[model samples]
Target chain A: MISDTAVESDTAVETQRGLVEIYSTTKSFHGNTVLKDVSVCVKPGSVTALIGPSGSGKSTLLRCINGLEPIDSGVLKVNGEHVGVVERSDGFYSLNRKKRALQRVSVGLVFQHFNLFDNFTALENVAIAPMQVLKRSKSEAYETARSYLDRVGMLERADHYPSQLSGGQQQRVAIARCLAMKPDVLLFDEPTSALDPELVGEVLDVIRKVSASGKTMVLSTHEIGFARQIADQVVFLDEGRVCEAGPVEQVLDNPREARTQKFLERVFG
Target chain B: MAQHPADLMESINKPRITRKTKTEKTAWIVLAVVAVLIVHTLISNPNFEWATVGRYFFGFPVLKGLLLTIILTIVSMALGTLIGLVLAVLKIMNITPITILVDLYLTFFRGTPILVQLIFWFNIAALFPDLFLGIPFTDIGWGINVNAIMTPLVAAVIGLSLNEGAYTAENIRGGFLSVGKGQLEAADSLGFSEWTKITRIIIPQSLPTIIPATGNRLIGMFKETTLVSVLGVADLLQSVQLIYSRNYETIPLLIVACLWYLIITLALSYPQKKIEDRYSKHKNSGGKVTATTEGVKLG
Candidate 1:
């Protein structure tokens, strides 16, 4: 476990890895708002956990940071570059599909369903994006893929297809696929939410190993204990609003807001 | 836990009791008798002319017609599939003008009879005697006589291919629609370009659905080529017609054509089954295959 003092000292030195800034971001679907005037800052080399109820917009916020879902109104910036929209002299203009896709190369998202290509083997799933999107040579992409699979302890099953693997094994491969892109920011949306109770530990173990490398990560999860152990900054959201945001100890141990305390009590007790 | 190991072993080793299945035995005997009776009647009937059927089975005119029929089936199916793939993609794009144009093409081809279409193409020279190759509304162009090019063979190919294209387009569009939305989102999140997404993710995922349907179309096209004989093309059926017309051995010549069609259909069916088996292996595991194999049994 990383001590809070060490995380603060590491944040002291600024690096251009993954810097996410969301300002008054609002999103809705069919006139029903999901994220209402939400603002959260995730500094580089820090793991920020968005802990909230099911409909509290944690997943939507993570998706907006990766440009998976477009925001209705507000500014979203990652590493000083606007995401999903471009700012002009007049106002912000939505980026075209092609341009938005190009911007997504630096951001990686791990879905709750694993979403591995059913036609591809584990190694192919990890290697395909590098070969297709980045235009890497076949040998080089395979080599990078093997290294990541090895990191996630999935190298032995590289030739196996998605259906051949269990949920935990598949999520580990999904993580390797995300890491193979070398994205500066990683977003995990309930990585273990779909796994069996016995399988959750394996995926969380891989996530813990990833956090030790000091990569920028934002994950929405229901596991409050795991969030306390891994997240440096914790943001508690309720009713599509951030009720409390601070250091892990401040938010989890000593929540300032009544909603945050109530949520923690319900989750813990 | 209550039973002794010796009693368990003895029970497991005993011969299993089986039912007689009396109805199944009776059905098998009845079917065998009916089959034997049919064979006896066919052999005894003199008008059937089994010898004449054997004689013309490999006759020169029949062989030539078989070759032409095979050629027509292959060419038309290849052209039809290509056109179908393009139209399916355009329909999926859903741009108003392009989609409307594609729909109109599909409707017109599917709604009309292929025989009429073939005859129309055969007599197209009456409508337009010359075909001009140039930009629309431009005076600078060269002309080619339509009658020189619109032979019966050409007309048959065009009619069969265009009509076949409409059916395949709907089949392929169904295949495209069967792919899950999660696959597309995964492709998008990986920063895949539209072309890459379609070629790599969408097409590959939809293939298990497309292949079985396409196999049925191939076999149907083989039989459907018979429609071309009305245009005076020298396909298998036309060759048989020419021979029987000359010798007046209509029954035997028709038998020969039927046997050949059956043989070719059986031959094509083998490979289709093999490909379907290969694809179904993944289909069972992925659980994304919605294209039924019901048509395969018919083919």
Candidate 2:
């Protein structure tokens, strides 16, 4: 159903479930520019893979989408509201810390390093944010967390602390943590990059299941084959710029840009 | 290829024990002689006055002083730690004016001797004859006489807590820094409010680093309460001095005080070890195993 609507025309989608649009967004750290005038429109319920070499701004773009990294220029809109920035009658102004925190509730991010809260059990890590930020009752929040953990096949390890679990188990729990929030857009910054070879399958399988659930996902990854299989649209970023972006088959199978072609050959060949 | 159990046991016989070297023997002899001499001196010394020490060890005045010392340590350390948490948060937030203010407070309290601080507080009446509690440079507030409010006991508590707060703040700041940047970022991405992030995420992970150092501070605070004796707070040391002065039995009274301190110090150490072990349990079980997973190849 989603792909049928997506194929008809991207613009005709529901405004309430509209595309996550990034327009001319740029970001920098200190004096070094990390993302330079990047733009992409990710359709709701579609999986968008951002592929690039090291320091190619792929991770930066993923961070910018979820308001973890503030853009220096242009706008990022999730559903319809501008992320990290509030538009007032006078002009645009960055949201204050509290307001920004509230705005972030609609987006969830999975990190490369699987940064689970060390002191908490897997269940507590998933349950805490909903109880604290969303004001859900303790029982209800924990129930929701357990359901998400079940979805990610991590229910058995719910009581284990992050350090006690395997890396892939931790990442599965991390994914479950994001899912527990019921976010509109799920952003993964190389989620599988930190897992073991045998363990990588477990986390990827979880992400694949999450994607099938119709939550919009934007991920930056070095997994060429995985991206080719799951992504509806693939964007190749190089040197803080989007060198190529289009349908997954066109971009991954028959890339038009030299940089994209070279990246693919180096990874897939 | 299987062998009899008896034959296997015989084949795996343990190596013979070796004799102690000359240096090891000499060290043992020295330690034995020192132990004997110390015990002999303590038992035989006429100046020790074993009866007086035994009587005064659980006597009314010394017992009262011990109770006071315990109270002072608990109250001051609790108040100081609370203030230290606030100062640590302020410093970590990096608000320039507040950070500078915290730094100045830390430097002033930490740089000066505890004895001097106690004395200064006891004489606060000289610095501010009238204490005001309202807007500065305005006559809109009421004033109170300082001498009535700044009693020696109050002054002692104020001095000890302020000094302890500075040290605790530095330790807490170190704890906060020891938490990885990725952990903070993870918390932020989870939509954790700043308060939730600090209370739930940062402080808990930082505990392993902070607890051991804070334990050291707690014991130090217990010992440092003796400084309040200079202000006539009638603490353990002060109580001993009072008795010694009255009866001219200084050595036995001093021994009583030393024995009490040694006993309390030993008592505090057990809890500290338990807390350290509780926080560090994960270190032995899980962290190293995942690190080796980095080299595992994935397609």
Model 1 misplaced regions, further than 4 Å: A1-17, A88-92, B1-14, B17-33, B136-142, B287-299
Would candidate 2 be rated incorrect, acceptable, medium or high by CAPRI criteria?
Answer: acceptable
Give the Å shift of residue B3 in candidate 1: 6.7
Q: Estimate each model's TM-score.
A: 0.88, 0.89
Error of 1 at A130 (Å): 1.9
- RMSD in Å for all candidates: 6.9, 6.5
TM-score of chain B of 2: 0.89
Clashes of 1: 0
Residues forming the 10-long window of minimal summed lDDT in candidate 2 chain A: A9-18
How would you class the docking of model 1?
acceptable
Report the C-alpha lDDT of model 2 over A24-97, residue by residue, as the tens digit: 88899998999888899998889999999999998888788778888888888887678888777987798888
lDDT, candidate 1, A195-218, per-residue tens: 999999999999999989988999
Pick by DockQ: which candidate is best? 2
Worst 10 residues of 1 chain B by lDDT: B290-299
* lDDT of each residue in B113-169, candidate 1, tens digit only: 888888998999999999999888988888999999999999999998888899999
